[model samples]
Target: MPRNDAPDDQAPVASSPPTRLALIVRGGWEGHHPVAATELFLPVLRESGFEIRIEESPDVYADAGVMRDVDLVVQCMTMSEISREAVFGLRDAVAAGTGLAGWHGGIADSYRGSSDYLQLVGGQFATHPSRAPEDRPGDERDNFLPYRVEISEAGREHPITAGVGDFELTTEQYWVLHDDLIDVLATTTHPVQPYHPWHRPIVSPAVWTRHWGEGRIFVATPGHTPEVLEQAPVRTIIERGLLWAARTPSE
Candidate 1:
C-alpha cells in the first residue's frame, strides 16, 4: 500500500482530480441497519468525486471485470456467507490495488466461515462486555456502557486521527481480536468491573489500518447505530478513512 510518490525534481502540474468509482456492498442482519447506515455516507462519497455503485450482495465480488476497475469497496455485509469464487475475486482485486474499508461488523464480522477473508481484514469482533444480570435485572441495555476511546501516540501523527483528542461514548464498546500486522491508531479499554469474569482490563483497537499487497484497508470499531455514526468526531474519522482507503491511479 505504498504511495507512488513522484520524484522531488518533477514539475508540478495543475489538473482536475480524476473521477473514481466506489462500490458499496451492503446487506446482512437488520439489527445493524445496513441500509440506513451506508446511506449516511453516500453524499460524502459523491462530494469526494467518486461515481458510486450500490450492491446488496457480495456476489458482485465474483464479477472480475467490475471489481478490477473499482477504486474502492465499502462493504457492510455482516455474518453472511461468501462463495469461494467471490472470495477469490475479492482477494485478487484488493491485492491488485482495490481499497477496502468498513466499520463495525460490516467488514470486521463478515463471512465468518472464510478464513482468507478474515485474514485479509486483519481483525474480527469478539464480544461487547455486558453488565451482570443483577446490575440491571433483565434489561438488554447492559452492553451500553460509558467508555473512553484513547488516541495512541502514533495516532497523533496519522492523518486519520491527528488532532482528535480522546473521546467518551456510551455504546456497545467492541472487544476486537486482531493480528500484529495492523497499525493501531486508537484504542478502548474494557475495565474489570465487579461481577465481570476478566481479572484484568482489556485494551482493544478502536481504529486501525492494514497494508495488503497493493491495497489499503481501514477499520473503525464504532458506528453500532446511526446515532453513533452521526457523532461529529466519529463522522469525521469515518469520512477521512473512506478517502484514505481509496486506490490511486498511480498505485
Candidate 2:
C-alpha cells in the first residue's frame, strides 16, 4: 500500500563532478540470473564513468574500508543468509552515505532472515503468482497476465523517471510488503483473477525510492527476466535510478 505522495521539490543537483565507485555484489538464486542481470547494466555504468568492481561473495559487506569509499552498491542476492558482521557493515555503509540500488528480488527478496537488511531496503517480496497451471492448484491457466504499469504523479516529476510513461508488461506481478516511508514512483493494479484473494483491484508499487540515514535506496520490480530488463523504458529507469542513487552530476 502506498502511503505518501512525491515531494513537491526539484530533483537533486550534484555539486561537483566526481569519479564514482560502484560495487556490484551478486550471487544467490540462479533463477533470477544474478550474473547475467548484473552484467546487463555493466556497459551502461562503465560508459557513465563509474569505476566498477564485481564481487560474488556477501563477505564483501563485512569490510568497512571497502564499503566506506564506495558511492553505490548494486546487489543481486536473493534468499540467502548474511552474517551479523556483514549485515552490520552494509547497514553502516548505507547509513554513512553509500547508496543502494537493485531490481526484482535482488534487493527486495534477499535475506528473508535479516530484518535489519529488509528495514534498509524498505520492502520484501511476498509472492509472485505462478504462471504454470501445475504450480497453481485448482486454477485452470497460468497467472502470468499482461498488465499496464502506470507512472505515479511523482514519477512524472522525478529525474529518475524522466521520459518514462505508462507501459505494458507481461510477467509475474510481484506482491510486496513495503514501508510507508518510500516515495512511490510507479505502480500497477492486480486484476481480479481466479488465484487472487481480493475481489477488487489491488494497487502495488512498481518502482520506489527511500532514504536510509544519509544514504539513498532505489528499487524497480519489473526485471524478473532479461527480456523485461531489455525493454527500453525499463532500462532507462534503472540507469537513471543508479545515477540518482550514486548522486552523480548530470551533464
lDDT winner: 1
lDDT of 1 by residue, 129-168 (tens): 8876675555547787788999999988999999899998
Model 2: number of backbone collisions: 0
Q: What TM-score number comes out for model 1? A: 0.91
Candidate 1: where are CA atoms >4 Å away? 1-15, 137-140
- Name the lDDT of candidate 1: 0.90
User: Which candidate tops TM-score?
Assistant: 1
Q: What is the lDDT of residue 19 in candidate 1?
A: 88
Error of 2 at 110 (Å): 0.4
